[model samples]
Target: MSGRKYVTTVGVEVHVELATRTKMFCSCLNAPQGVAPNLATCPVCLGLPGSLPVINREAVRLGIVAALALNCAVNPRIWFERKNYVYPDLVKGYQISQIAMPLGERGWLAIIGDDGAEKKVAINRVHLEEDTARLAHSGDNSLIDVNRSGAPLMEIVTDAVLRSGREAEEYVRKLRAILVYNGVSRCRIQRGEMRVEANVSIAPEGAKELGVRSEIKNQAGFNHMRSAVEYEVRRQAGALDAGGTLRQETRGWDDVNQRTFVQRSKEDAHDYRYFPEPDLPPLNIDPAWVAAVEAALPTGYEDYVAGLLGQGLTAADVDALSRNDALGFLRLAASAMGDKTVLFAKRLIKDVFALANSTGVPLDESRLGPSAFRDAALLLENGKIAAEGFRTLLDVLYREGGEAERRAGENQLFVETDAGAVAEAISKVFAENPRLIEDFKNGKIAVRNALLGRTMKAVGKRADPRVVSGLLDQALQHQGRADHDRDTRLPRGKS
Candidate 1:
């Protein structure tokens, strides 16, 4: 343990349930959550005798989209295989999946590495498969709900390229954004629509081979995955340092304890006894279909982000928009708001999204729809409302759907537009702060910001900013010129 260095590595497997209307190989409804147990099941999903499976075209198209998103090469011809395993949740002793020839292969996703440089995470494959049933355990019995069975699931496996928990988290986060942004999946990790498995290992620096690895299964979220990987690395490295040989195994994360515990010996590909699925025929994707999928694809995530950044959005703003799932709403509101897109984005992220996070409400659940957002944004953009007034208007729109202008008028939130009142307010500020005016005359011109603030305060923050600014500038210019004239007329000490 004397200054010895170890390198930790992780390879992650993520499974996302597709958003198709039907199951992967049957016509059963794809909705599993909130449905009665086994209601969405069918003969094929239930694995009844003589029930043949038919591949869903929508699911396949979604897979192609997903593959393209990950920068994968789409395989021209693909077939399914039977992965045999004995599990209570797997009603079919042999689950249908793609192994020998998957929909896509050799994909890579770019992520910021531990060194803070852009690095690519090599992807082994992206394939489509069927999900198993849901299992709920009680005191001594287990309940199996087949509602989730046969749902189309896409699996993305990354090579052992990640060096730390942070990199893994970023990879998953970016991947989720790409899929969700493309309308490929909702990727609600809490609801099990997207799941993660991470393989973690550590070895002394310059070791010939990677030490034995442990597979941590079914982390609930990206943070949980990161935590699990970190813990596994520490545990494995400690064991190796103690001169103990590591063993390959499957493990589970104990969230309450913040640790990983062994589940069982890990299974290899041979252990699954995979073979060509005899019931389903192979699919050949023709050029026309491939072209159609390519056309359907949206702007790449990186490209869209670059465009947003070029439009004056900070990288941090874009990241926040993605995290809050506000990107789609931004797109809609921006298209309607025209040149004011950047301003709207700032208000949405800073004010609205923050409010949502604080109130335990999702952005989608708020009463503020895209149209309502455009209305509120217009009020702010056209200077009918102050920033404070805009926030208030949004608050009302979020809780009670009303016109932005009506809400602003009722709340007395609009800025005062009367020229007489604005002039009067500026005169009052000028009279009250004689010292500031003297300083401004003495070439302390930056004091104008203080003068402007005083003028805005004098109007109860209801004055149009442009009106205050223009009036203040004219008054200051007059004062500066008079000061110069007086100085010239009387030589300082003589006067």
Candidate 2:
């Protein structure tokens, strides 16, 4: 037993179905959305005898691209091997997957830690495999749906780098974003398009050897994984404290009960007896084809941020922009207007993003388009329009942009800034509020604020409060000086 407190390590295996048109081994619609159950099934997918299978080119391309996006080293020469298993979901006796030579090896995903620092979680391998059909379990028996059988699945395994529950969640989120952005998979947790299983283990702080590993199976979401790991850590720590031995096992997360229950004893690698299939010929991936796929790979959000950094975006701004998709639109608007990037980012955070978030709409769907934004930003930049007018224009655009040619067309709604009109309102306010004015002359500072409020109510919020307050203060100060002068020089006969 070690003297130190505790340390936990986690590795995650994610199974994400590629969003390809056809299945991995047979040419059935890989996606079953909006289609009747079992309608997309084929003989090969149903495991009918004497049925030969052909690989989907698109699935292969996506597998390679996913590997690339994860920063994996792509293997040009790879082969598919059948993983033999007997399961209800497997219409076939075995699943065809890449075993010895996977498409990707040794990749990494960067995660942001709670301490506001970046950490990289290494991916041990990413392989191409076939997904079996799903079984719908009801009260009594189950129904089989072959529509999803033979769908292309990408299995990503991670090295044991995550040291905490939060890190594990961050790693999954980062990986999901990369997968979705690259168009390799939808990676929707709600739909079970992407699934995560965790291998959790703990060792005392100074222990040289790791404790027994328990596999937490079928973790539904990031939060579930976090909770399960936390519970496991506590359970192991308590057992160790009491001098009990930790056993290797498979546990199920009972989300409803919020506890982990023993599903069964964990299986070692040799338990299922994995063997290669002899039916399919060795998959010879040409170098030229892989290069073409790599060239067409989508640039991930991380890469986009790096590109922005090269263009001189600050670290904080980059973090903010990446968190908000509106940052992309702001970038587009800036590019179109040919403005400085930093200036655009400042305006994005200053006005555009704030308004969009307040309205609960996407930036693109907001009334502020590239042209409108550019015009508004230009007005603000040159001080041609007051901030009050700018905000008003945003409201106007939202209400009546359909009828107006430009935002300036709605300028009729803005309050007039004429000095004569403001002066008249100020004079009227002073004449009506005699007591407040007397209090102001008596050097009571609070009375000046009351006079400013009366003047504001007489006009409207559309009027610039700052300018009105300034004019009122000047008037009050002049009156005060004149009254003081008259009092000081008053003749004795008048008293």
Candidate 3:
């Protein structure tokens, strides 16, 4: 494998389903999950005779938004093309997609590469298309669910600039984040809202010409996508070393076997028999519309992360907040909390996120809203409630909606700041641990922490830790001075 040097070239094709209320060219419901098979279909989506297609305006607008977000140039005039193919899941023999005039072209997304440098992956086009139905295969039988059919799909193709599997993974990850942030799509890989295909080829190191590329179709996850690309690279390299030839073909990834198997020869553009769709008219994207969409785009993800970091959030917290559903909530709380943003961010990561992970509920869907979160943070900040009390209140707030103060009071979780109570607790702890006091007098000052622990336990978690530490220090110091005076007086007596 090391005799001849080779460089791997990778390009990616990502398809994302738009979160629209209806399908691409019809008014049928777009809900694909949990619906009975063929329940959401209609004449247009099922491709019944005498059915004509009409464009979904909202889907087109979303596609343009995604394209602009990727920094692509939107075409002023674009039309759909019929991509002819045969498959059971494809109700229509020809897929209505774009070829000659895609919605947008020449875009790029920046991804951090293996060398830790920002690398831009060139986007070829962001086109609009319709999704195929779901195919469920049993031992020997197959079933089609048309619920997914006709859902608006966006195809984002990237130039073959990625040199490694890691880079490809990063590219797709960044792309998904951008799309999700822009509200263009949910981009959930597990839900089939997003799919990835990698076209991989290897050429001799420093060769001016590229080698034959093979397409790996529909990798379900990022790990699978990277593995498929890496496996194909090695396979091509091994074949060339053994004086065998590689062919332009399509392959499917076997997650169980951890390898790629041939599916069919790859098809070129002409193979699709592309033609203009007569049912839908050409889409006109005016400059004013493009400008409006561009202006409405959200902050770039990098900028968003940077802003979060600047707000004193740790890098780990920033990453967690950015990737999770709680991001919007965090932002809202941060804005509302003002100078206490870092405190809220920490609590969110340490408490709310941990609960969400354990309970399998997303943060955004939790009963705890931004106002309740801010109130809890304020209580903790003002020392009205200790850390344990705050945590208890947060759990209640997350599970059941209530005011933080009312919940804290109902649970008897207020911090005990009474001076007399703290003093009595310290004296009780000293009485219980006479040996600890004697050791302190003998200069074993490090044992003060043990004494503080005892005092806190005596207070039963109602006392503030800071108050307990202060009271304990005062008692020890007073005992130390008394012992010194008694020792000096006894030494003068020569006893």
What TM-score, computed on C-alpha atoms, does each candidate reach?
0.75, 0.65, 0.77
Candidate 3, pairs of clashing residues: none
Q: What is the Cα-based TM-score of model 3?
A: 0.77
Give the alpha carbon lDDT tens digit for every residue of 118-196 in model 1. Answer: 9999998999999999999999999999999999999999989899888999999988988887767888888798999
Error (Å) of candidate 3 at residue 364 is: 5.9
How far off is residue 337 in model 3, in Å? Answer: 11
Which model, 1 or 2, shows the larger lDDT?
A: 1
Candidate 2 CA-lDDT value: 0.76
Q: Write the per-residue lDDT of candidate 3 for residues 1-495, one digit (tens) a residue.
A: 558999889999999999899999999988655677889999999999999999998898899898888989999999999999898888889899999999999999998878899888899999999999999999899988888889999999999999999999999988888787667887878889899999999999999988999999999899899999999998999999999999999999999999999999999999889999988889888889889888876566677667778878889887787677455566667654355777778889898888888878777557888888988888888888888778888889888878888888998888998989989988888888899877777677778999988888888656788888887888877887787787752212212
In candidate 1, stretches whose alpha carbon ends up further than 4 angstroms from where it belongs are: 32-34, 332-340, 350-359, 364-495
Between prediction 1 and prediction 2, the one with superior TM-score is 1
lDDT of 2 by residue, 304-397 (tens): 6666677776898866664554444554556532336667777677676677677776454555665666666666555455566667676565
The candidate scoring highest on TM-score is 3
